[model samples]
Target: MTHRIAAFGAALLATTALTVTSLSAETLRWARAAEALTQDPHAQNEGPTTTLNHQIYEPLILRNMAGEMEPALATSWEPSADNPNVWVFQIREGVTFHGGETFDASDVVFSLNRAMSENSNFRELLSGVTEVRATGDYVVEIETEGPNPLLPNNLTNIFMMDEGWSVENGAEEVQDYAGGEDTFSARNSNGTGPYVLTSREADVETVLTLNENYWGIGEFPLDVTEIIFTPIQNPATRLAAFLTGEVDFIQDVPVQDLAQVEAADGIGLGTGPQNRNIFFGLNVGADNLERDNVDGANPFADVRVREAMMIAINREAIQQVVMRGQSDPTGAMLPPPVNGWTEELEQYPEFDLDRARALMEEAGYGDGFSIQLDCPNDRYVNDEAICQAAVGMFAQIGITVNLSALPRAQHFPLIANGETDFYMLGWGVPTYDSEYVFNFLYHTRNDGRGSWNGTNFSNAEMDEMIVSLSSETDLEARNATIAELWEMAEAEMIYLPIHHQVLNWGVSDAWSTLVDADDQVKFKYFELN
Candidate 1:
């Protein structure tokens, strides 16, 4: 098992690693398992989407590959001396968007408000903010509902866009990604980051060239002048691209090909435990599932069925065979890097066929039932395989699973639209906090939170507990609340956690970089030999 506890812990209470890149390569071709959902920065809060955005967009603050807090568009930020609720950020001077628009505090104000809008996927992260205003030419003030100590942490991936450019292009509104609305911003972008978008073909290829006028010209290596990114969903095809030098770097090297990649000359395999976990979401709150054949009653609504399903599939076996020993089997959603993770919380119950069948019988499901398990074939490592394995395991408990695997682009919508009874999802914590997980995954679907909560689980009291995390200033007390919330989420068994994902990046010897714990690659930090 990938060292289940090898992450940075509170040290990540914590962010990125910066290594010097020499001037050598002018172009770098990158390949990953999936592509960004959209070019609109706030459209999708998915990991691949954010990672690609980091190359073109600039956030007020960002986590480097090492996972450390670093300055980006904002030079410095601190809570106002007169008001604990207000956070003041000093915008970077002389910085301009790709379209040459000057960056200022007004742009910051506009971008934040846009991110907090109804269609934005990032609204949950900024739900505590009550107001955002330009206090000066280069000073922006953000007032939260209360003292939000971890405000900066949430800003790590909240990228900023040019206010003037966005309005002119009729992209003032965020993309309604889950609703399948595609606007101008979803195909084009203008950011103040190290690179500028040359062309984007969505799932086909995206070309980016370095911004010669970027503010960080002297501060960063700026060696890689151009970037050619391709998303090859097939594992074998992606690996072959890397081996043939058709691609310079591969973000996800399949576990089955690790030995081949390691043995290949001029290739280096970078590995680390990512701050993400893979889980199966069950629609337990629904009175009757939309795809199950259990009459008017939902089998998942019963706790015994949920628990039985949870303990039936052997995680250790999946870790060894499905993942090929590149995963850490776990029961908790929060990875080791997050603020609320504890060893005790990761203790998953052992798989027992007899117990699972008995529980199924107790839940009046001993005769078994059929359910459709929606899964993504290109999203995570061995994602479809894991679902396929579960299908067999479920059969032992008299539950028949009908597997429906699709590309990430098609599979995610089913969850968002509440069209699937069961699904597979992976979450990465950019904030390195538990509040982010609870707000999006545990809270009841409402104004800003629970946008991804497809399970239909809702609890007013638990929702209150989840909401209290942003304003609770006392660290010890806030963590206590997190523990309580975790207990509640676990007791409900809304999701069955499989494991924390392990990151594997294959790099050419010509360039060097670390396996970013967040799985985000910043080309500016790539070191050339």
Candidate 2:
């Protein structure tokens, strides 16, 4: 069931092959289900996209594979003594971009400003920021609307771009990803990271070389001299590459095929719980949905209908059948590792087919309505199968769901641009805080926030509460507000929680890595055994 042929290969041919003489132990051949959406660091806030970008582009701060904060482009950050509203960052020195440009404070200020632009998907994480200025060379000051303590946490994925290279290539503005606008930055990259992008062929393969001038040369193991990344969307084909030793490290070892991977020799399977959750979003704010067969109104707009849909979905069944006991079924939007997740929020609603049917009848959807469910085939573990299971569950409540599964590239835009009535999404809290969750999922879809809020649920009162979490310095009060917000979101049933994902990576015994809770693979941290 595991070793099959990939349509694209050399390092991925059907039979056993060696890319650099036994993976070279220096060249790490890696494969995953999805590819980075674009090369523009600030374009997409997705897990796969950010994970790839982390290899080539250096962020001000970084969450290492072990989920600990480590200084990257910036060595240290602290609030300004002169003003609590202003935070000061000491940028790393003697760093050079792949294009041979020197790194400095101006790049941080420029990159931060660019990330706040309208087209930037990361703008929500930088909310409440009023100004960014270069106080001095290697020193930058960020002034917020008020005293902010979690600013450093949000900067982990906010990558720094060379100001001169960006401006010269007309990439000063973030790519309009939802608008389908392509720019030079989307295809090319110049970063101050450990690896340099040598070549790229989207969805096919990409090559990166070791950066001899990397600032962390001596600080890290730096044993991996080169990287070969390929996007093998087909799980069987991907596993085949790994089983045959064509690929050394595969991040997603399919749940159904985990046993087979363990049975193989010279390969190790690493496992852990990831800080992410899968959920379904509904277009509740729209008066009418284009994809649903409902007259003059949105069936999902009714809270009873949402509740009916929620209770009808059996998380236990999904966890056992679809995920193969590789998931933690959840009721809350935020994962357990997050700051605000509680036992009360973790309890999912009881599954009752009769009650679900009654609620549907009470909500005037007794006859039910047909709607298309948008899902990505390659994004999560058995993402399409999970939707398929839900189809049968929804059918029990008199709802007809037509599933449309597409590749991640085409699927994510549908949700971002408000083009889907119902869709599947997975969220990972890099900051491990509820503010990061609410800012993108609960806030109104405007003012550079809620880019991921495909639900169309808008409330001024809720938006104010979401924004307050950014600048509220009091930890006790901020957490209380987060709890209240979670209560409100859960009550509204804006999203149907599925389960938290588990991490399963298969690697060659020549190298080893810690299982990152975020499921991010930083090859720079790899240790040669």
Candidate 3:
């Protein structure tokens, strides 16, 4: 690791020297609060990871800055006329990977199959897929369990990998991100996207150069020829880098410093509401939480206790204080942009301290119990501060919250492993549908479904409805099922919905880009001033 870091630094210096002498306008220096977890596309389904991978890997379909579907690797796709259960894609021709491997239907089939593997973090996204096959050189077909109207929507983030290159590097299997396993794919990449990875130092810096032979060279802006990504965890340091012209872009601008950034001379701020909801999850299904003060049973298991905890949180206060009036207090797990979100579903209980206290007593926990809340300090805007506020709110009702604030890398695994009693998580529906949430958070944890459901709240009836949403061709029937699932989750208090995050991106005036509702910055759409 030491040698690799040293080599990466040397390579970056050389690239910087070359850019200083020539092609400076073609270079884009990007920084963020946290770096991508890994380079293996299927290893982690995280925002940073997916944002970084978008430059190197090409998904068959991609959501643009406006959150609308656009064709990329695949020119067009539609359900097969002979079989409604089968979706066919016409893969783009004349595309080549960074390593010179031609892009074709074989790579698509291999990549999707690899994503469905047990260890892949993206397995949940392909839950309804039964089989994938290459029908021709540039044609691929996916057969789901039933007639899935939204099958194409789910493929928006499924990136294509070079089958030959993966096999040659012995990385045919996906990286086991949760298991702490590493492979060559985690540190290397070869794809047909517009950018190629030149050098990478995990959690430090990654360098990319434009693919000279990119198929979309003339079609897209493709102005930025080089990219230097630096992950600076400190907000001050990151903002300073952008203000001082050390970096060209900063994805995550501190919410409190938004005004300062806007007032800065050479820097500009792009602000929008992200399609994500921040929430807290409790181990309600556990017989006895391993990290709670209560002995015989889990207090969170009681519905009244869960409701009491929910009502105790002051969402409006958190939005005004911790978020600096930049967030929208949410009552539902799905954000407004997500389908199946209704005004009634977004109605949360009124903040009633006396009622919460009384409910706690009624649940036979008048004395209140203690529990730990695992939160990620760097993943979301004011994530740690939100947890801190919740600590005090729960304390008002005699509940002692031992706040465990850690970086996202450490905080997320605890929930994935079911080690944390209560935890905080933020969800963004990449597919823009409720099924995306149900597959990962509501379904039973088994066979690649519910991979992130740490609460262990599993119901066979609910699971069946969730699975049926994928193949339910009737629009009316599918929407009704979605509404039913949301009602069930809300009534059970599966999670405490906090608020929807507001995005602020700080960028140099030298270039301009769109602000995606999903908070993903795709440089391909950027243009140099």
Per-model TM against the reference? 0.96, 0.95, 0.95
Q: What is the TM-score of candidate 2?
A: 0.95
Choose the strongest candidate by TM-score.
1
Q: Which portions of model 2 show Cα errors greater than 4 Å?
A: 1-22
Candidate 1 lDDT tens digits, 1-529? 1112345454652232222121237788989998999999998999889989999998999898788899999899999899999999999999999999999999999999999999888999999999999989999999999998889898988989999999999999998887889899998999999999999888899999999999999898877889999999989999999888888888899999998987877777777788899999999899998898888899999999999999998999999989998888999988988888998888899999999999999999889999999999988999999999989988999989999999888998888888988999999988888999999998898899999999999999999998899989999999999998888888999999999898778877677565788888899987677
> Weakest 10 consecutive residues, lDDT, candidate 3?
1-10
Candidate 1 regions exceeding 4 Å error are 1-24
Clashes by residue pair, model 1: 15-67, 15-68, 16-64, 16-66, 16-67, 16-68, 17-65, 17-66, 21-527
TM-score, cand. 1 vs. native = 0.96
Total clashes in model 1, counting residue pairs 3 or more apart in sequence or in different chains:
9
The deviation in Å at residue 103 for candidate 2 is 0.6
Taking the tens digit of each residue's C-alpha lDDT, what string does model 3 give over 306-333?
Answer: 9999999999999889998878887889
lDDT of candidate 1 at residue 332, scale 0 to 100: 91
Report the number of clashing residue pairs per model: 9, 0, 0
Model 2 Cα lDDT, one tens digit per residue, 135-247 = 78999999999999999999999999999999999999999988999999999999999999999999899999999999999999978898999999899999999999999
